[model samples]
Target chain A: MVHRISLVGETFVFQDLKHILASASLLRSGDELAGIAARDPVERVAAREVLANLPLRHFLTEAIVPYETDEVTRLIMDSHDEAAFTPISHMTVGQFRDWLLSYAADTSSLEKLSPGLTPEMVAAVSKLMRNQDLVSVGRKMRVVSAFRNTQGLPARLGSRLQPNHPTDDPDGISAALLDGLLLGAGDAVLGINPASDHIGRGMDILWRFDDIRQRFDMPVQSCLLTHVTNTITMIEKGAPVDLVFQSIAGSEQANSGFGISLGILSEAWQAARELNRGTVGTNVMYFETGQGSALSSGTHHGVDQQTMEVRAYAVARVYSPLLVNTVVGFIGPEYLYDGKQIIRAGLEDHFCGKLLGLPMGCDVCYTNHAETDQDDMDTLMMLLTAAGVNFLIAVPGGDDVMLSYQSLSYHDILTLRSVFGVRPAPEFEAWLERMALVDGTRLRMNQPYALPNFRAGS
Target chain B: MSQLAQDPWGPLRRYTHARIGLPRTGDSIAGSEVRALQAAHACARRAVHACLDPAKLAVGDSFIEVRSQAKDRSEFVRRPDLGRRLDGPSIALLKQIAPAGPWDVVLVAADGLSAVAVERQAPPLQNAVRAALAHTWRIAPLVVAHNARVALGDEIGALLGVRCVVMMIGERPGLSVSDSLSLYMTWNPHVGRQDSERNCISNIHARGLSTGEGCHKLCWLLKSARKLGYTGVALKDESTNMTLLPETKTP
Candidate 1:
């Protein structure tokens, strides 16, 4: 006989009884129980009575069966007694498994469930799920949303400007900026990594990008990829700073190598908050992380790369950053030797970061020395797009000369949109349409436009 | 350096290229400090995108200039595989130059991430190593390969039938020093050898390892490698013991 028992608040004795009945062939599978639950009132009541009357256990063999043996399940039950996730934790493994399958079938339930759910609880439940189930769950949990200027992200796939020139020359910088914008890129942020450690040059680059952004009337934010202290100094100097950037490692020692502490990060966040430069609301920090950074900085603390990465997310979550991206394949071949390892790390970082309630993106990139190519990047990009990545770094042609690596390009953004039917952030899309760069959700670049006359030849 | 302008942290900055203590004015950085950082940043950027000019490198006409399979700087940055081997015509040229029995060593200079590094640091370092090893080794013609990576030396060495290959390539540009070159020496050089199979000597620049010191270290390692018949992790640098003697002292 099939029965859908409401397992909530059921004692251990009752669970033991249910298991004993199942083992003795008295009970059917969860699907059958769900079917019985769908039946008329009389059949459902009869099925419940049959389940309740079953013998608790056969004591003659002295075989002891325990439901709390699985550590993950026990932890879930103990931690999830609060109102938000209690219903999920109280479910039997079979029932929870069935619910997970149903949830995967229709992920719109995630928006309904997200309010009460913490990423930790989601992570706990995820331990019982399969790979496909994790993907579906990851695709639905839009915990953090970013709005740069007027462009709201994670509502659509957003792209960042990575115009890395060797010198922070205004003319050279302007050319790359115009090129990227002409190809319909950088809706997320205009980010630059200066080769110089000078606070003034970094500030100059920030001011230049902001000026160009204003001239074009583009609703984009500008970031200078410098140390947090330098960014703070620039803000004090009255430089137009939108977002502060830092590379964070997992362990304490590694972060120390970057001259950062949790205290310092909080200070930077506070500094940016006080400036309040952007049109968008606060959350004006950007962080980039990767595997092997901890080990490289002599601060791994004997932790594995993936765990260290997740711990790094906890640090990132503190800032409520507008963006937190993992440069998956950029570390080198030593840690992630090939494309296969790179792809796996990207998905894991994305899934874990999303679970931790961070706006996650993946810089699908690789150094030339590694055994990876454009095809590998495409595979990771498509999977990340499917997994609902918030943003990606968009360079001119996938070649970053200054950084000495390859990343996503303008064409890659278009490819993701055409292949996955993903659009730019809603506001950015409207801007694209207004500029006639796209037609009814389709990106179209029939002609190259001339550079604006405001700063002609600089 | 003015006493007033000196960093309060003292000589700590001298030991590393990383930016550390700087003199400050009130709550802001001093003007001189800002300009110094700007200068360093400009140099690094110039090195990252600079092209190699064989004539300016002035390693002499005996060195045959060759191009890797990568057609340009952008292609070289994007496709690392192309930078690790010679083009078909360049391969034919290598065959024409040295067609037979293995020589003791083949030295190559490649413009890696920083062409300025190769141009500035490679000549003095290469000359010192050659002068030291002139008696013991039959070295092949010096190869100046444009748009090449470290592994490109392996193919050149294999085609020329050399016992070992040493490539002096530009290291990635750091904000503190853009013109830093690195040496990678591989024993029994051939294609498909992993990076772990090579021994590296890094930070060969004005502020780091001087050309004379770099040559001494390179010569000691090369001789030890020739004796041990390998150059990777198996061969450790015992050159420190050699430098302990008074006669081998570096100035």
Candidate 2:
């Protein structure tokens, strides 16, 4: 029998034996799609059809802003009054949409059109906004973001460097490359990021501490700082700060390596030790996106890059010594995730950069979004854990972040009980209980509560 | 002799025999090793101590000796614990140097994990503290602690009866670098007390927290803590009163 078939670049007319040859050629050249050129109309038509179906905006959007609004909603619902209406009524949909589109793509306005943004969505939006502002400040401050990851395994190390290493033991080479990198810039660098927002639902978890800060007149420099301080206060006042960071994304920062905030924290810790002759508590923490707003022209708004960098550097230097754990990074609002997958990817991007080396450094991916996907939270945890990120955070709502966090805490205990035949579920349960209290609210260590009244004046 | 055995950069066995099993040095080797160790120790020590003084210090100030025994009451090199627990003579000296109690703030600089870090970082930290204190308008006593941690500031604050306490201590020796310093602050100074009750400033070394920036930050933290009436993890420093100055302006 004779057969005639056309591929992207050429047409082949073959007898029975040649048909076998064509099949083999197709199998060998499958990945050459990118390099292939359509020579005939049918091939061109087939290629165009295939290419048209491919999602391009999806890829870019996924990379830039990886958050799910529905997930954020679930988290808010889980931890806070789900029926609570957000103050979206204060701003017109156009205003909100304009504000969102200022940093994000046109599709980012999807949730704004929904009109009635759940408290969860509001929280998620608020958090994403705060992170955007914080990153702006960091850029302005010229604060060099430093990081280390907790992947400890060889493969991740290889992926960081010599990504195309053909050897089976490429990760070992990656580690060596990292070692060399640190050896050169050792003294100049700080610690890694420990995303401590994983403790309970972030905003829901944070509300208790925020309320306390209001009651105690605590300044609102950084939400992480507030949480740390509140946690410490609770410990001092006979509540365990340990519960504040239990399960979820809490351990990512506290576990070991310095994340964005944790790196600065290590610096602060050193400063505290040197100036105050003190030691941080046993429960270490890493917070992300603190001190979002600052005074510019006598108005409170998000900080610019230089101001944020200066402040971040100042905080890093001042607080280095007291670091029980280090935190680092500044994710912008463009990467905000209210009910999308972009939030997780954005967090991963930061995690990949900030948590390049260190024992505890993990993707304790943090976002200020009130609403998020519970599934995404789990997916982030799973993805990050698989990618060497074990910690994550989300406010309690219908959003996935909160759902994932709450679920992960129980999941952790359940996994431990099932795999290791141990029952640490009480610890997770206790953590949830403590998170429900005002005094025991702070999520991370070495961070303080930021009250509404407090403002970064400079 | 066999050629492989005699070869200098031969296979694994020969190299191991030539290097690992061999004791190549005598007094000179020992001297070199000691020199290297001392050099490392001095690097950390000087970085920390330099934080204390900005001026081109005289030879005597920089020349610290790690002696086997104490030379005088001021000698902290010989006794690490003595640095931790003030000697009777040292305590007497502190009493004479310090002002009357019940101050608004107290600053202490201690040689914690690495004395080298303390020597190098202290001067700049002190200078920064002075500047920050000036702006905040508070009474402070800058004390040099031989051995201490972040909480030691609270201890001194309690003894001195100050409103708040700020302490600067050495950071743990990291593999990447040594000689890093840290700062801690508290609303009330108490021994073995609250962890979150205090705030911190850290990495006050050339490589970590630079002195000029560290000092300004310290002042900001202290001022904020004082204004807020609390510090540690819960304290928030949202005050934007800080003014940036050129390097030449700071003296």
Candidate 3:
């Protein structure tokens, strides 16, 4: 159907829903690169004007990537709840935005409405929203997921202790891991991005991490960020697997680019569940997603990157992941351009993920080549925490040597926790007190701190 | 550097390059840490925006210079499509350099995201790769294009009618690493190739993968891509650190 709108004297024509979604998005480099962005600023508002009147049910009727060819699309359609959508069925995209920001969409209401919302519906409403609107609505939605620790609870912030090393050195990882723990940074998990996918190397890292996790009796889970297939093999070999990690995408084709499928993911999810590693809850999947991944893989099927990003949450929602985050600014200037765009993208991803019933986090990072810096990350971090995101990835001094990208530092996370008056996961916070790293959200002063001890074995 | 100039874990930080256990003031890092990051950002800005010093690279008549459609650094950074194809005059120049050829591979050295990487590392990597693959492949003269991306190699190779393209370009700079380089090899080089249709060897720098090792891997991939008649998913990097291993003395 031809979607058209007029602004002043100009008449704007859009090809379809996908085209309108791309045009209606705020300025970002990825949409422009896809050649689907509005020709000018006014045309963008015009596209949004047309999109505003679109009935909420239009997203359910017109599949963005097509339902037949894509498994992610199939999963979304198959899992949607007609009963839950009835409350907002009559609202247009504009009306839906007002509804989300109004008093009617409370904590329980959003939770019940989550299953009925498709990525497209949330994405459309999000594009109509301002940053404060995103924050106001996103902050109200509480999506608590648990493995060994509860995350995304009200008045709490979670963090992943990313102890990534260039050579998968145990001593190096241990050093960073110790640094993270002292700053109260690993409430979500102590995750490592191993340099290589060698199975022996993966199992070695896992065992070393498990040793620290066990000796401290820390409530935190541990993961080696390798491919899911490698983790599955390690699981078979009796390695202490806590979370099965993979970089997932919105499109089935792009997931294949990562060499994953719903079938493979199901197998890994069930396998991890069978191990019964969690002391608190049973969510066993950890996923990292980013905008432009599908486009980067050349399999976006003409959908905008923002919509593509939301679709990935659909895939993540099916598995009930303990944690899900977008490596937002790490995709670089081609996708996000600069600090302003990166900040907006981070908030949007958080809002969309929260709305779709997933525990969302943001890496809040940028490459040196990108025209952004620590100041921008500071803004985004404060925004995400205010929006009540589940977690943030904290590494040593915000520099990931293995990945070679800058993210939030342990100190930065501490600052955020201090400013927001939010604590770590309840169980992990108890462990922090037990270890005497902190005296009720304050770092223990002048106390002789004992760092972690690694058993002398690989 | 005023108070707590010394980190308690300073000795253990040698285990990794990651900056750990920074001195803290309340919940924030001290001034020196902030200054260090600013210094890195400045270095990286120079790496990305500074003009290439091709003279420092020591190229001769065998190397031809060209420009992508992107006229400047800002446009090049923003418009990737412009960086992936050569300008009209540049295409004419490439055609003039080699009117027609059945070369095995064409080597392209592009000043991608970081021109500093190309200025510092390209000469060593390009020379080593050419010398190593001289026997097995009929390689073309190095094509140095400014304001270019990895896909720029495709159009250059297609115009030269080469079977494969080995692209040595600057990777996006990390905070502490502004000059790390990367190499991408693609078979049947063309204008619109998916990233999956290539094999990438990244993180080549002073502290990362060495030029010698990068050359070895590229040569191996070239040979494998020829045997398999493809480059991307079907072919795998079965490379190891055998070159760095201590040579067993043959008694």
User: Per-model TM-score of chain A alone?
Assistant: 0.75, 0.26, 0.98
TM-score for each candidate, following the candidate numbering: 0.57, 0.30, 0.91
Cα lDDT of model 3 by residue, B1-251, tens digit: 63334555656667867887777888888899889988988888889997776786778666778899999998898888899989999999888877556689988788898988888778887778777777888888788889999989889888888899988899887777889889999999989998889999988888778787888788888888999999997789997664732222111
Off by over 4 Å in 2: A1-458, B1-102, B135-138, B237-243, B248-251
Q: For candidate 2 chain B, which ten residues in a row score worst on lDDT? A: B15-24
Q: Give the per-prediction TM-score of chain B.
A: 0.85, 0.60, 0.90
Write the residue-wise lDDT of candidate 2 on B18-111 in tens digits.
1111111310113443354335444433443332331321223322111112233223322222343444555455455446544677666565
Error of 3 at A384 (Å): 0.8
Q: For candidate 2 chain A, which ten residues in a row score worst on lDDT?
A: A157-166
Sort the predicted structures by TM-score, highest score first. Answer: 3, 1, 2
- What is the C-alpha local distance difference test score of candidate 3? 0.87
Ranking of predictions according to lDDT: 3, 1, 2
Candidate 2 lDDT tens digits, A242-333: 12221112112221222224433444333322332112122133333221112111111121211221222222222211111112112212
| Residue lDDT tens for model 3, A1-458 | 88878799988899899989999999888888888777889988998898899999998889989799999999999899999999999999999999998998899999999999999999999999999999999999999899999998889999999989888888888878877887788988899988898999889889988977888788989988889999999999999999999999999999999999999999999999999999999999999999888887789999999999999999999899999989999897878899999999999999999999999999999987678889999999999999999999998888888887889998888898889998989998888888778876797532114653443212
Docking class of 1: incorrect
DockQ, each predicted model: 0.03, 0.01, 0.53
lDDT of 3 at B1: 61
TM-score of the A chain in candidate 1: the value is 0.75
The most accurate candidate by lDDT is 3
lDDT per residue for candidate 1 within A324-443, as digits (tens), equals 889998886546656876877787778767766678888999765455667798898988888888888877556665676668876678778878887777667777777787667655
Model 3: residue A37 alpha-carbon error in angstroms: 1.0
